[model samples]
Target: MSEVKLVAIFAENKTGQLAAITQALAQAGVNIRWVAIASSEAFGVVKVLVNEPDPACEVLRAKGFMFSLLEVLAIAVEDQPGGLDAVVKTLARNKINLRNASGFVAHGRAVLLIEVESAAKARRILAKKQLHILTQEEVMEF
Candidate 1:
């Protein structure tokens, strides 16, 4: 799988927090590709994959939003049973520990963004199996 940039925004779980974040990004014209929100009572963590992560980061930074950039692998898998199994098994066999992951289906494909111990090794292993790894541009296509 190839590496993609993910932006993490830490904000209060109260109202207007996400509004301000999205508004700033929208004002800067950052096209958000995919977004996931994880929350408890106090705070929420918003992870986003955008068309241009670097520009998004700069825009949010200037807006005074608390955020960070993360390197995540975008892997395109089959939209059928055993599809995820094949990918995860490959990484597991290679001694790569999966720390966190998120997935979504679009264009009839199951796209998974994974955080692992060794992205390079995971890419090599998937490459040998002829799996498709998404680039930044490709991710936007979805």
Candidate 2:
């Protein structure tokens, strides 16, 4: 499947909050593949892709952290400028509104991870355009 699970941990904007989260995950032996932190004045969302999401979620629960599992598309883009724009344009043309998006380069591949209103439909549209979508195992390999 092209859908990959992302762990979105909601945290307060305080010192050492990130460290605590990572520490807990490390203690639980969860390998984080990618992570992004976005914050406002008082709160933040820590999004992460991990090697083992189910166990990671359990660890977060045991640690009293509030988080959710989000299914997102991992699209393979060109590892160059405009690579992301190209995918965005295609989605825009199809009237697919992206809820969230981020990118990373790993294993010599440029990946665009995105959350949309309808993942299945979006996948179909992107597939028609010849965009490569990463499978679950493929994403973990990175």
Candidate 3:
């Protein structure tokens, strides 16, 4: 149940925004492990998990980008039908509210990134049910 940090950027939904942000990080030698972008007609939020959070943040700040660090949970789920559904239902039944979620498949397993109201509580609840919660090191290795 270690802490995982996600770098969230608030930017306008226009050309070059994402590129600029990513380019700055890249130039600083920050390796991005995962990224999710959600946008509306006017603005967007770019969330990323990088190898070096501090360096990435510094690069973003030096580049004049508005962003924040978000603590999130990375859970390991089975790569099959009903795997994600079961986890969501368990959290809902336990009174855990899911704020944001994104996932990806790697090495034949599904990694679910969830933003919850109480990450520690959610982690305990999930663990009690035998769900595998990935550690920060495990996530970074991906």
What TM-score, computed on C-alpha atoms, does each candidate reach? 0.88, 0.92, 0.91
Residue-wise lDDT of candidate 1 within 1-142, one digit each (tens)?
Answer: 2458889999998889999988888988998888888899999999889888877888888888899887788889999999999988888888889978889998798898898877788878888988888887788888
Candidate with maximal TM-score: 2
Model 1 ranges off by over 4 Å? none
Residue pairs in steric clash, candidate 2?
none
* Model 2 misplacement above 4 A: none
Report the lDDT of model 2 for residue 112. 91
lDDT of candidate 2 over 20-103, digit per residue (tens): 999999999999999999899999999999988889999999999999998999999988878998899999999999999988
Q: Sort by lDDT, best first.
A: 2, 3, 1
On lDDT, the candidate that comes out on top is: 2
Which residue pairs in candidate 1 have backbone atoms (N, alpha carbon, C) closer than 3 angstroms, thus clashing? none
Best-to-worst ranking by TM-score: 2, 3, 1
Candidate 3 lDDT tens digits, 49-112? 9987889999899988999999998988999999999899999999898999989898888999
Q: After superposition, how far is residue 30 of candidate 3 from its true place, in Å?
A: 1.3
Clashes of 2: 0
